[model samples]
Target: MLTDVQLRRLTPREKPYKLSDTGGLFIFVQSSGSRLWRMKYRFGGKEKLLSFGTYPEVTLAAAREARDQARVELRAGRDPSLTRRQRQAEAKRVDKQLQHVGEEWMKAQSARWTPRHAEDVRTSLERLAWPDLGHIDLDEITAPMVLETIKKIEARRAKETARRVRQRLSAIFLFGMAHGLGRHDPASVIKGALAPLIKGRQPALIDLEELKHLFHQVELIPAGGIEEPLIVSSFD
Candidate 1:
């Protein structure tokens, strides 16, 4: 067993050397003076080495615990090195997704949406959402940030535009979530926060004088005339 004092006193040499401890665990002293922890084992008749960490950082007890866990895995016929590599790859893939941007999300939708629509979505994010929320990690975006971001559009009296932007942003976040990037769609939290749209009255000739004038104009036109029907339907 290697004590703390002995491990600390072990300095660098011209070549790397391994100080073995029980159960295939050892301290590797490198020529550069770095003390690293390593475990050696055989799996499927082939020897393999698994690095734990450095001295002081990994410590003697931590190295033993890691080695003990590796032993359990070995007993179960599992390769700890392969499992660790798979986990590292998965973490890297997740990090790449999390670091992705709104533009990437927009681009992914290009196959399903028209170019103009995709361009509009990108433009909305760049103009309204990006300044405040785009550069941030997808999981870090909260409902309040989404609400505040849309309020900028609402401030310009673009109620309908604000609604469209919110819908687009929500779709983007949902897409990100499906791809394992985002945690939730913050824009969905403010469903009814924007101003309601005002409906306009239908076109009609309500004035009595306007109705008489329309009849007079129809009479002025020749029978079976296209202009008369067009003018009449324009008021209808």
Candidate 2:
């Protein structure tokens, strides 16, 4: 058994050495004068070392308890090192939410985009995509769910808005996948399914009578408050 006094009294030599305790737990004293707690064990016909912690910060009793817990895990046919890693990974998984990850992706890409474009990206996602997806986890989203979300925008006669939203969704999913936050890009496969962007549809005033009526209405407007320039906008 390693005592607190013995641990404190341990001095570094020219080379690193180990002071073994019960159940394969030991203190590794390095030449740089750092004492690290470690355990030696075998799992699946291979030897592996597990670290408890450094001396003083992790006391002798704490080290023994950790070693005992690791032994229990090992007896259950589990690898203690891998179990620790999994717990660590779970604790670090704070960006599982789609909106959170999307915002993060936008911020990361913002420097490459114009300020107006970045704001537009943020607005489009928040307005058209987030109500359906913001609360959901990245991995939980499906292609059908994405389609449904954009379909609402298309139903509003906003096909152009829907196209932009879909493009942004694909970019967000791609960003999530590239960063290991999601399994796949659900939006990438459905680009062709959206309502097409319509341009230059036939004017509502298709005949001479309707054109004259529209001109009459325009004449009734009070002159020159930016309305004339707006009304006379080039077709191009």
Q: Pick the candidate with the highest TM-score.
A: 2
TM-score of 2: 0.53
* Model 1's TM-score against the true structure: 0.46
lDDT of 2 by residue, 72-114 (tens): 9999999999999999887556577788888888889878865
Rate residue 11 of model 2 by lDDT. 97
For each candidate, give its TM-score against the true structure: 0.46, 0.53
Error of 2 at 158 (Å): 1.2
Number of the predicted model whose lDDT against the real structure is largest: 2
**Superposition-based RMSD of candidate 2 using all C-alpha atoms, in angstroms:** 10.6
Show the lowest summed lDDT stretch of 10 residues, model 1: 227-236
Q: What are the per-residue Cα lDDT tens digits for candidate 1 across 141-214? A: 78888888888777665655577778877877887887777679888889777777666643455533334435
Record all residue pairs in model 2 with backbone atoms less than 3 Å apart, i.e. clashing: none
- Residue 22 lDDT (model 1): 83
